[model samples]
Target: QPFTYTTAPVPALTSLTPTSGPTTGGTTVTLTGTGLATVGAVRFGATPAASFTVVSDTHITAVAPAGTGTVQVTVTTPGGTSNGISYTYSAAPTLSGVTPNQGPTSGGNTVTLTGTNLTGTTAVTFGATPATSFTVLSPTQITAVVPAGSAGPVTITVTAPGGTSALPSAYFYVSPPVLTGVAPPSGPLSGGNTVTLTGVHLIEATAVRFGTTAASGFTVVSDTQITAVVPVGAAGLADVTVNTAGGTSNPVSYTYLPAPVVTTLIPSQGPVSGGITFTLTGTNLAQTTTVLVGGTPAGFTVVSDSHIVVDALPGAPGTVNVTVTTPGGTSAPKTYTRVGSPGI
Candidate 1:
């Protein structure tokens, strides 16, 4: 009787562990399925892998070979070539930094990544969120626009032909700062006044401004404290804002006071002897009105919401209006002429 030899059928590879790795080699790949016992060679696409060992009838361990793009692994045996297997060859690109780590929730902001193996990048993502736009500027650089997202921090990932690199250490955070109040609500038009800002999420304040004018100087003390110099501005109320790495704060009003203006002097004629009833009319009068005679404040009485009566001292007979001063500025003098007799 003649001895008979039995041949096992080649197995079909269902999948490959870490189906992808660098073209530089040193990656172990496990091929699985029913007929791996007779695998003559493990080929990554048309190129043969570095080495391969048959572990069992259903498993084979193989070292990845250098290549780019997708490749199929096939096993050859006495029965002929088995079904084709597929794997991707990629270069793991690292991300050193992400410029402008923060962006608007609406996304669409361009960001630059710096590191090696960045060429042939296939995809860019912010955590699980995919970027809206991306471009491979060079082997060591990438430019991608952020997609809209919620207010929070997210890890960025870059994928290339070698494989996805480690998740970037830098993160992207999206949130706008909030402003509540401004100290010393009023300031002179000359600027240079220090004002305190109170708000939330002010940790990375970059710029401060009164209206359209940027603050002369600014310091971020904490997430809720900011001191800034008021810029020269027109007389009136304008919004104040602080910009930070997170975002811009809500605007708060900063009042700018202009020099007061005087219109007329009631009882323009007064007794030279002093102690006469008179009224001064002017805009922007101070809350506490003062009667000034020759630049000297004399005794005065506030008679109404917009009126004041003064008892002048025995000074040289002359005409001068009572001037008022306030945070808004000094008011023009109201002219009062001296009369022959004292009148109420």
Candidate 2:
């Protein structure tokens, strides 16, 4: 005669992936151990998990159910309930706000965050990019230095032992204004020339400047374009700049030309009948568009930047005022003597 002995067939649970989750549940945890092929039920403390699937003799995937605080996770088979493993459930964190939410794409800007359940935060991010640095100030506050981020609106979030905060589109990244060039860069010292400025991120322009002086007027044509009126400035190079929401742009050089000058008039004396050719000496005369004798139009030709030949118009026997008009401006008047006939 022979004697036989009975053995136990209980399931053994060694561990669970993601040992913790939010109390609201819905976290899928993997159970690993021996003798789990025919698991009948998986439980978080006294409550049973929502759903579970057996992969083999040693693996099972289960979705957690609603519960609070720490709980013992266990599995049961036809033999009996298995030994329990520990798991924790915590509340989801809430984010009320983030300070200084807007920053340059170049990053390295410090930002302050305000919210609840922020203590023991493991990470902070703008979009998917992690912060350059961060410090948890308290359960409801955190400070983080943003990493380089792409220009545009983005969501900022904080992760702690509880979970990642579901913050909405809570931050913005702005690209600084950059100026490539300004057309018709040079104008007369008197101002009033329309200039076109081309660049990047030029929308919502608040101001345009010539050197230190603000432009008389401006219009934002696009994110990369702006039209401005040149303002009155001294004769010299003026730095042109555009200011937008982003910031001031790089400078483009503009030159202002002084008013035309008339130093001397050749053959200062002329016949009362006029029609006499006169060679005028002056500075900045190349752009001369008009010549006048006693307020009357006189034909003129710009021989060079410094010289102009003009035909004197009819005037009275006495002296009359002679002026030259150029792109820069009209020159001061000079005396032109008109002689009467000796017979008269």
Q: Give the per-residue lDDT of model 2 (tens digit) for 1-344.
A: 89987665789999888888887888899999988987899999999999999999899999999899999999998878889999888777788888876767778878889988776688898899999999998888999998887788888888876788967788888787899998876668989988899998988678899989999999999988999989999987888987754557888888888889999999898898887888999899887878998998888888998899989877679999999886577899998999987993
Distance from true location, Cα of 218 in model 2, Å: 3.6
Q: Model 1 clash pairs?
A: 11-35, 90-161, 90-162, 91-161, 91-162, 321-334
- Compare the candidates by TM-score and give the number of the best one: 1
Q: How well does each candidate superpose onto the true structure, as a TM-score?
A: 0.65, 0.61
Q: Rate the local accuracy (lDDT) of all candidates.
A: 0.77, 0.86
User: How close to the true structure is residue 210 of candidate 1, measured as C-alpha lDDT?
Assistant: 88
